[model samples]
Target: MRISALAAEAGLPVATVKYYLREGLLQPGTATSATQASYDEHHLRRLRLVRALTGPVGLSVQQARSVLQLVDEPGDDLYSTLGRAVGALPPDGAEPAGADDPYPRARAALEALGQVYDPEFAAVAQLEGALAAADDAGMPITPERLARYGSAAADLAAYDLERMPPEPHAAVEYTVLGTALYEPVLLALRRLAHQDAAVRRLGREA
Candidate 1:
């Protein structure tokens, strides 16, 4: 296909596609003439992945290029690549543990989560502290329970990441479909939980 067709198929403007080519996000196509270039399906797939990484995720062009490099590498692990990218996002709030804090509980929780989940230390710490704070505020989950939950969560996350297809186009579609469907699917789960709780409460009373 020609460059124009590739741009259309990828749902990006022609100039955006050209810019990606110039930025090395998309590999150069075969030159058919002095001004015309012919792109193939691989280029189209790469362009779509770049669009998703940079658009919805807000990765900078350079960051998107880095991600594309990982995706293109023959032996690169996509799960690790995505974990690193997610870990690079800004930390939520104050440092996980205060410099002068005497207690080691928060630090310990974070370290435990990091050992179990392999996320960045700070990310794990932030998650742990959030769970702890929620429990302290009587959200019904204790630190020990949260640790077990984290283990289960890690297993589910790894499974989902493994299920993603290796091809760039397939990856892009997987992300799009996940974003589109996950919220409603989760809402359905929440509704099921409500119904189950109501039924169990009535059964116990009976």
Candidate 2:
């Protein structure tokens, strides 16, 4: 297929596809002539992945490139590649909270749950930010509530990761895409569950 076909099949505009090509987000096709190139299924799959990353995943082009780079050149281990891919998903420019403040709270929360995690992990920072905001709002997540949420999250993670492919590239792709796509489902389910619980407890619409 040609670039136009590739774009059409990927449900994108030709100009957008050209832009991706120019930005090095999409790989060049096999040169058939000075003005023409032939693409294959590999290109189609890559194009779709690029669209998913930039569109639904809400990553900047640069961030998508970073993730694609990892997919193209997975490092020595799947675990590290996955960690880096996850680390790359969040938009850049999140200034770390002061070391002493959020770290202690976040670390303690994780410790209370017996979670073995890197204190410096991006998610730990995210958790710290959430905790700090809740504290400021006077609706702090108590230890019991934290433990409940932590247990549910752990179970969800297990269910998600168990289905991931063993291959490094596929595993990274699955992790990134699943994280992006399934988060909304989780949030919706949580809200729905709250509604159901309210109806049960209050005996009225909630």
TM-score of each candidate?
A: 0.62, 0.91
Q: Scored by Cα lDDT, where does model 2 land?
A: 0.85
Please list the Cα RMSD from the true structure of every candidate, rounded to 1 decimal place.
Answer: 5.9, 2.2
Q: State how far residue 147 of model 1 sits from its true place (Å).
A: 4.2
TM-score of 2: 0.91
lDDT of 2 by residue, 63-162 (tens): 9999999988888887778878887776332346565554767778988999975755567767777787799999999989999999999999999989
Count clashes in each candidate, considering only residues at least 3 apart in sequence or on different chains. Answer: 0, 0
Top candidate on lDDT is 2
Q: List pairs with backbone clashes in candidate 2.
A: none
**lDDT of every predicted structure (CA atoms):** 0.66, 0.85
> Could you give candidate 1's per-residue lDDT for residues 1-206 as a string of tens digits?
99889989998899999999999999999999999889998888788777867875567898677656654552445545555444433335334454454224555565667854433434555565565677688885566885896687678668767888878535644644353345367669879988899888876554
Q: Write down the worst ten-residue block by lDDT for model 1.
A: 87-96
